[model samples]
Target: MKAKYRRRFGFKATKNGPALQSTIVKACASVVIPALNEAKRIQEVVAYALADPATDEVIVIDDSSIDNTAMLARQAGALVVTSSMLGKGTSMRDGAAAAIQDIVVYLDGDLANLRPGIITSLCLPLLNNEADFVKARFGRGGGRVTELTAKPMLKVFFPELAHLAQPLGGIIAARRSLLQALTFEDGYGVDVGLLVDAYLAGAQLAEVDIGSLEHDSQPLHDLTFMANEVSRVIFNRAKLAGRLHVEQVIAMYESQRQVTAGIDYVLSLRKGRRCLLLLDMDGTITPSRFALELARITGNEAALMQMLDTPHDDAITRSERIAGLFRFVHKQQFEQTARSLEIRPGVVELVNQARRAGFMVGVVSDSYFIAAEIIRRRIFADFALAHTLTFEGDVCNGQLQINSAFLPDDDDADAPICKSNVLRCVLADKTPPPVELIWAVGDNLNDLEMLRLADNAFVIDPKSPKLSEEPGIAVINAFTDLVKLLGHEANLVDQK
Candidate 1:
């Protein structure tokens, strides 16, 4: 359950200090996990990525895995993509190409005991605009091949990079732009190749401490093959850099000859509607937050403000507390306010078109299901998922029932009532055909998880400008853009 590799790290950058912009502009990242047949460990690895606040997107690049690596990753809320070829380097390159964030991180699938802040630590330098590329230095010492082969070779050939603690470490983060401009080797040489390319690209690189990254070490034969491949690439790069002579090239080829066999490049969720589109009712479908509207109209705005000012006791407790504020509100007034809220333009058409395109369109809200259902029918969605409010004698009874769909599942039992959990409940149904694409739209912090879980996400006028830096999330000002996006995506679905 824990990684054995551990090592200390010291950052050399003197230019930028700690990330003060973290409060306003998050250190958003797109995590690219190059996995191959790593079924047992892939799900946990993806979960580590998903749990990070900085990780807006978790992309699992399946390099023709034989096991359920891809399926488990998808089930764990990662965006899975099949590699064009069966190589870690190809997966890395393709993952970078697919990433839409400013920072792209590559994580080996087999790594274990990954700290929750791993991505944030790897990305902080880049977020503060200090480093162009980052390599993770774990607590454990170097692997056999790293010590016997990579380090010695780097010392001889690329002396400038000889100081790197983990030249062969697979945990790396770099600006997407930098990754886009670089090339990825298609074998065991990929990690070293990236280091050399980044150095050659004149990227300001930094290494940070990611404590206790442990994994099963490669066997002697596998280590031999890895050392051969790694040395081969380093020599090739040295030759390209004109740092090697005829004798060194001959020595490299000699080593290749010494190694008789080549290495195989390796390393390496859900049922429901064939496709699902979840729209957040408050700001997503109604263009305005229903809670704020209700508070203002009922003259209980201060009570609602108090709700925000108070620390949440627990999700259920918070829901009950907020529902208590509506005790003075009558059912008729609630219905009137829910019905009076204007639906955003193009929602009906988007929902309808999405359904026709094989998507089960629904509205998932943190607010009451009654209001959500009202909005859902207004847009003609298939269903609505939200908390339920009780009534007694035509007035709210100050008791709230959380939607089962919003409650935690077996994976995260103690977490808050998140829309993403509702999505999981829907996708977990075995009755529906396999889901093709999950499209989601939302507007605020509450909706962040839902958007992240969705394959295609649209954030309506995001409050935090940082959302724009996240991958697989689009910030839209108007509703018409969503209509167009759905139509285009629908065409792709139809073509498929």
Candidate 2:
């Protein structure tokens, strides 16, 4: 289905027109600010944009601010556009219309610690033809949730965007050619919507550190609204990109929300009992495509497997080989392909059952965090350990950076994460005491360590190519058979 709202301000195409084309050969650069009640900081924001020589024009769209934001922006030599519609999206649209330049830079007006260099840092990539889009990152900001939540969420579900550091940040720069083609959501979701849309439209993107900036931290009370808006933006983009099926979208939403709500409730209960449920990504929750898919997209799949599959006695050499494979696949294509993967049947039911059984579910995988996050969101797993991707703007640096907590130390013997390490961590974190019953599941050789660590382990749909063949691990063809194995009632599963 087509998006309900369309871009009205930018270049419009006529019916049966011979493709829309740009009028300007060289796109001028404009800085667009969507301001609300930023009377104190609007002028500083305008000044920063104007100070950059590359920025030809500054357009500030006031979203019905009761404060003197428009007046302040005008005083700073910016062209002011007032919008009665009252939203960041509407303001952006108005600003885009007033812009004479083909390259637009959007900045939040409430930054108290705004730096002049940020303007140049954000716009330079787009101006020099290095990237089609740029996202700004600050040293001191309330973007921890964004880094931990949104970015990882995008990486897993929208792998094409796995490289974007601040997907929901208020600051961005994009070429008019790409900006005009996007449908912006008119709420808290606008930033994320733009990022996903631009990436899906095949724009080369990157993020740059603007040093540091301080802003009002969102209170814990606002998380629900943020999550809803973020989810809406992600789901809509996924639907548009054909990564998400319409019917399954509803189920996906329900399953995710339920898992999150369940976790919240479980944490609140303060139960002393602690149980751990370790999950595998590739084939257990979703279909395994990392090897073949990476090969097909990057043309380096064989080389990647050789590095991973070969008997590497040297840890450093093994790490280098894996990193080399990631370097070959462009972040955008990797994400797009990952999103197209399908989840296993009855996976949600199994997760809900596990949650009800008082198991503290978490994922331990050698895969990228973005890939692990997809499983986490799909099943509402509490935590995940995976590889990290370094991003400058929207594009990746092609470096495979692992999370420090998951990294192996010099003294550690059994590779970085022997399933025993994951088990020990979970067991140690239990509030009262670790539960006697612990269950782990997997389908690959990577899971062998964890499976051995668990009190009981289930190997689901194992491929013949895998190396390990542990005797204690019960083989299950389908996840639906889990309830019977665990002696649970089928009706107890939370379908919602």
Candidate 3:
């Protein structure tokens, strides 16, 4: 990127030059990278961020990649967040929303070329308070869409931004506070949208030269789509600024919803494990639903059937209501029911095989941990995560306690402590799980979250048509499919 294109730049409310450098507290940046199937090089990108002294945290938002991206990034020492298949904009917003640092920098995951000081160069301006938003201008980058669509549209609609070297560049840094305040365009337009939004919001923006770099070129078809999206964003922002008002707007995207993941809680899980394998308890570990079985055993069958037949409530409320039916049910009775529930075939063999192969096998459930533990012992799983059933004396008090591990940062529905959130928070050992994989098995939608986090995910006897709606999740009738997903991890026992 040469200085020939309008050497020094300012947009909207940004001053001609930054006069307020070096007055704030020390800067600690969070590097947020939105990745899809870039499993080939995500580790190096994450490592670069972690190695930088300026980076306080490295977060890779895995966009439902079928590869080992999430597990690998975590093993490489980054806090990994498993996002839905929404797109880059959603990933960016989620990453920044979860950032602990004041400064947030986003880098592309597939970059094969990177200079050592890239992060420092991007953060220096913001660190010293020289600017509120910083965009990276790197040399030797070939951005076909930027040259054709992004720049031309910028020239027509946002001429002040037309001079930017790489308007579509994903490498950008901004004040996390301001980034949160702006609405993000949740598609390929996120980068440019942020640029315009910052300018419109009166941010002091700077374009720093990061020197030579290379990026993987997209296929022609993908490029065509990207160009259209980029053009649309520029046009949309222009209309929002009241530049173009021809009747109504076209292709207006809803503002992105920011999420606050329990990153600290995730980082606090059991460490020093290599691989993590989570099996859903109710249907996978035990053939029958524990609640239904308990209802039958305790003579609360009629009440339990009524509760199940009634319209379902929110998970929290439904859990409470169900526990109310079990009021005065003794712990021993709960354990006895769990113990009596028949185990799925090949269950014991699978756990032993995985554990011997250096994997951490655990039982995952939406039911109470007390019952989950009873199943865990039968299967010999290393751990379990489930809603806690509070007891008064020997009987359930009809109150449930969701562990801090399963608790959400807010009341947001998507933020619930699903299997995905728990996985995002665990298997964070810096060196990694013994195996480089994370395998999860569940019978229903409850395990859908882990499908986003695990390198390999399997659905056992899928209970809903909605489960089939999820792409890439292999549905299996038994542990046979799980072993196949395990894909030849040898069963090697640890020799002390």
User: lDDT per residue, candidate 3, 1-496, as tens digits?
Assistant: 1111112221112222221221221337899999998889988788766655466778899999999988888887889998755789989999989999889999999986565556767888887789999999875332556654665566656668767887888999999999999877877888999999999999998999877666676877997888788777888889889877442222111000000111222232334456778888888788899999999988988987777666656777777788888889888999899989999888898888777666777787888878887788889887777777655455677887665556554646567666676675564333223335678888777778777678777787788987777877777777854565443643322331
Q: Point out where model 2 deviates above 4 Å.
A: 1-28, 140-149, 245-403, 406-496
Query: For model 1, how does the per-residue alpha-carbon lDDT over 380-438 read when each residue is reduced to its tens digit?
Result: 88766777775555567777776666667767777877778866755554332445678
* TM-scores, one per candidate: 0.46, 0.48, 0.45
Candidate no. 2 TM-score: 0.48
Order the numbered candidates by lDDT, best leading: 1, 3, 2
The candidate, 1 or 3, that scores higher on lDDT is 1
lDDT of 2 by residue, 1-496 (tens): 0011012122234442111222221225788889889998888677766655456778888887898988888888888888758788888877777778878888888776554445556666776789998888754222434543565456556777766556788888888778788887798888888888777788898888876566655777786688778877887777777777654444343233223222223332324435556777777777775545666677776787677677844644575456666653555665676676688888778778777776667766666665566657767776666655544333445666544444444577566644456565445443334355678888877677778877778888786544235678888878887865553422222221
Residue 293 shift from truth in candidate 2, angstroms: 39
lDDT assessment of candidate 1: 0.75
Better of 1 and 3 by TM-score: 1
For every candidate, C-alpha RMSD to the true structure in Å:
24.4, 17.1, 20.7
Which stretch of 10 consecutive residues in model 1 shows the poorest summed lDDT? 260-269
